[model samples]
Target: MPAHAPARPLEIAAAGPLRGTVRVPGDKSISHRSLMFGALAIGRTTVDGLLEGEDVLATAAAMRAMGARIDRGDDGRWTIDGVGVGGLMQPEQALDMGNSGTSTRLLMGLLASHRLTATFVGDASLSKRPMGRVIEPLSAMGAEFTASPGGRLPLTMRGLVPAVPIEYTLPVASAQVKSAILLAGLNTPGITTVIEPVPTRDHSERMLAGFGAELTVEPSPAGRVIRIRGEAELKPQSIVVPGDPSSAAFWLVAASIVPGSDVTVLNVGMNPTRSGIVTALRLMGADIEALAEREVGGEPVADLRVRHAPLSGIEVPPDLAPSMIDEYPVLFVAAAFASGRTIARGAEELRVKESDRIAAMAAALSAIGARVEEVEDGMIIDGTGGDPLAGGATITTHLDHRIAMSLSVAAQHCRAPVTLDDAAPVATSYPGFFSTLDALAGVALK
Candidate 1:
């Protein structure tokens, strides 16, 4: 399941109830930040439950290239000895960032003020994604970039030492853009501020504080104002990553859609900023119960017990989009099985993910005989009233891992088998996805 493996087609058929308790991989957001922040800290930082997926591995590789001594122990613990603030070494070669947009964008911020020049290259899919959102802010802080047309990848950037600090307001609610600015502030010489009109996931903010950076968040009339003082050293600490709720989202929706399915996903990160899927599903009458809710690694953790239930579609609130942006593709799958029409709006961000998720999901769903309409910002889906879909189409996943997995879950309630053009992309985030699905359904899907 390597990131650059040959195309592997997958076919999933309607299966019996998916019943079991499963623990997904580590939270991808936390896994990426843990490695980056650990690399920037002054001492040894140890991480447990690190996701060894291709995306997080890409981050680990990038940090190692920039002078972090990172190693994984036999006991599944990763230890990083950071070079401290202003101590990054210039990489000897271009950083190859596989298919991870998170690795590329966040590292752009991490390198913006390091007084080093780095060239970044990625796979074709990542190359097409817009880097301008991150580039615009980091460039404002004095980083010079020579990017592809439209600010795409295969870009060379020269970092600025003693980078200028600025209060940048988000033109969009993107955690990557916000995180890049904060990461750049770590090497800058003054107070760096970001104004987020709508809150996205706050993993960057929380993890920065955990690393002992002088960062603060205050409520603003516009939204949240986050300020980080630059040139501050980070302290290394032990971290235990929680299960990714984004990965857990697939099972939650699967159990809700497939009759007689009951599944419990363990130790899920329930950070309020990233729990919009849970909220939206609850509104749609999904039978999701939070069990053993508690704190883990300074974030809320819960074991989610979901039982099959008839769902009624409802208007997905626009404000919920930021928290659950990555989960929208699968949410559309859940919507397809609900009792009525589901309308999703204010999610234009979906258009720019690994694929145009809105259109991708629309086309894939429609091809399989689900009623879906592609909208500019989002999608409108008419459910089958819990009926199984006629799944005789081969879906093109467009090299998006979420798309591949989301459609796989949709196949659970399909009459025929649903075929994916490529499932290799699933290794980027959830390498164990198919195996886990097999275990839940008690059938081998190949």
Candidate 2:
């Protein structure tokens, strides 16, 4: 691993009402799946516009270590020549996934089916997130794990030979766990089924299908049931991952509430499972229009046109949490700039993300003199309604990418610069965030 210098603290002055267009990076969820699916396929898979962030790079490294021939070209494209299903080798070094839970959890599934042994490690943030949810299902498939007592990382996995297939119903709404089980099923001997009560992101299903895996999804009265046939070969694919809606949320909120600011974000993902932010924002009276709607490489995408408008708070249901789980911190930020109050419930998952997002966002917003109430599952934010935020405070980022980005956006309307501890982690999801925002509006950092 390479060590880089820590980020310096900086300030952002309040911006004048503005207008511009910005395009964010490819979707993080889809980007991770691209690599994982490509590695599991039998032939060569080509990927364009993949996010080169550190976290996704960690996934690429882990796949290469698992015997995939993955390489990068000068054209900013990536190619992976896979070792075929069930052909993954036992990695010599412990897989270090850095700050990516998606990468670490999904890799565990692929490892569960083969007859191999491997260890997983990560940075401090990744070390803290519980992996037990994923471990339990994989364990039921006959794999064994030696992990920390509470199932934290620095864990070793012993893959199951003649792995048994399972009809697992998810206890929680997690795309990671569901995808893990489905990936494990790729090499098992029978049908592996997953029942998701609330559908999470569907990238794994769509990409798996595109790669020629035998998968069928049926919506039952019980839930959305997915069945994958085991020991099936996956063909190579040409993938063009869509832009991340989570990354687009910041701009969507900013443009929606900045009062006279208008912007267009091109080629953004409109996956139904991940479009809750757009839906919730529109429910709050956001002025947004979707244009050029089309399907690209098995994912739905469109151009989003947004303009500044008055926003009012609305009650967000717990059932919608799984769709926009990664966008809550910034949604809270948007709520702070809206009219009335925004109440979010059933978001306990926020507690275990890159940081305790609820606590981190609440503390940071309150420090800048915003009135916020943090609840067990979610937060209550009183909007400022275009009023200048009481700034002159530095926010603690806790090394979380969304926290760093959210606070940076809040600084745009604050009285003084809201210096963040380290913004370097933003690269994990939105590598060009600051620069793109800088070009669109006035944001200065020192």
lDDT of 2 by residue, 1-446 (tens): 33344775656666665477777898889889889888888889999989888889999999999899999899978999999899999899899888999999999999999999999998888888999999999999999999976898889999997899999999989999999999999999989999999889988898888888899999999899999999989999888888999989988987876767889999999999999999989988899899999999878899999988888888887778999999999888888888889998899999999899999999999998788999999999998876768888878888899998888777777777777878888888888888887887876756
Collision pairs in model 2: none
Q: What are the per-residue Cα lDDT tens digits for candidate 1 across 67-136? A: 9999999999999999998888999999989888999999999999999999999888888899999999
Q: What is the TM-score of each candidate against the true structure?
A: 0.99, 0.97
Which is the leading candidate under lDDT? 1
Candidate lDDT values, in order:
0.94, 0.88
The Cα RMSD of model 1 versus the native structure comes to 1.4
Q: Identify the runs in model 1 with alpha carbons over 4 angstroms from their true place.
A: 1-4
**What pairs collide in candidate 1?**
none
Winning model by TM-score: 1
